[model samples]
Target: MEEKQMDLVSLLLRPELPNVQKELPTARYRVKRLSELLDTDVVFTLKGLPYGKVQKLRESMSDDVSVQILLQGCVEPNLKDPVLKEHYGGATPAETVKAMLLPGEIEDLSRAVERLCGYRKLTIEEVKNA
Candidate 1:
């Protein structure tokens, strides 16, 4: 009798298979206007927010969602830093973000963070399952 080939489903179900998960991704964005204001490059490092946090932000529907996202996702120019907060004359991280960034800049950074978190509009073909 010949042995049968194991299918993908069977292979995946094998208990011995090591669980391999990739780390969350990060990206850097340069705010040109800010850089110009500072007379140097003002680049910010941002990481993807976890699904739970993103879901909570969505459900809250707060006006400061963008600021909240920046506070959570920005790894560089640390928005939560005490010095930055002082410089911005903001008492909280969210206030610092609002004071430091223009409305359009906040929106742009929020969109960038969302992209890193795997949010994007599906193409028509993709929506059709092509």
Candidate 2:
């Protein structure tokens, strides 16, 4: 018997491809798990991170500010959301990578992960300033 080796994109799009549509959160979890198994960091732009920090700005300056700074700094440089009329975004590094993976675009998964990690580093810089 022979074993088969599958690419990440194929694995993710196995059940569906042309009509592939997954819930954002579910996709995030899948990406996170894959990254962990592969010993890689999954990054996301800050816009993807949910908002609600202004209220906590005074009570938890460090945490709230850190989140804000991270969000502002890590947003995707060119990607935009047609529905939102804004750049595509996610709440965490994982979400960012997940968002990039449309059903048919799984082939770009590795590159997307790399870009996200790079963005994460930039976001860290923003945290320092905040």
Candidate 3:
């Protein structure tokens, strides 16, 4: 039994395991509607939200949760860029996202952010098995 426990600990300590301190996972999403509007392809790179930030966002219960997520998680095109913000009438990143995307689009992007942040439902049985 002691040997088995040591083996388990050794397996957990393997160097190949991911280091949470490293870069967060990222994904690219193409905004088809935006592309049509701009007459060119527009791809947005998004990074996963940290668990602590997601928890805070959920706890806040703000009306613009989706906008907040996009503001923080959207990496490509730099929503906070001064030039882009100026082009969008000097709007903040949140305002720019609201002006650029419809409500449905905002929700869709928020869902993607949630997935990246590991927000899927899991069964207790699965946890126990793992």
Best by lDDT: 1
Model 1 whole-model lDDT (C-alpha atoms): 0.83
Could you tell me which 10 consecutive residues in candidate 1 have the lowest summed lDDT? 121-130
For model 1 the local lDDT of residue 113 reads 84
The weakest ten consecutive residues by lDDT in model 2 span: 20-29
Clashing pairs in model 1? none
lDDT of 1 by residue, 46-124 (tens): 9888888899998886688888887788889888899989998998988888898999999899888888887864423
Candidate 2 lDDT tens digits, 1-130: 1233456555767755433122111113134654676798654432222133323442565432433333333444323344332333665543443464553333233333333333233544333534
- How does candidate 2 fare on TM-score? 0.19
Which whole-number lDDT from 0 to 100 does residue 105 have in model 2? 33
Indicate the residue-level lDDT of 77 in model 1: 80
Best by TM-score: 3
lDDT of 3 by residue, 34-70 (tens): 9999999889888888778888987885688988887
RMSD of each: 5.3, 20.0, 3.0
Arrange candidates by lDDT, highest first: which order?
1, 3, 2
Hey, what RMSD does candidate 3 come out at? 3.0
What ranges in model 1 sit over 4 Å off? Answer: 1-22, 121-130
TM-score of each: 0.77, 0.19, 0.80
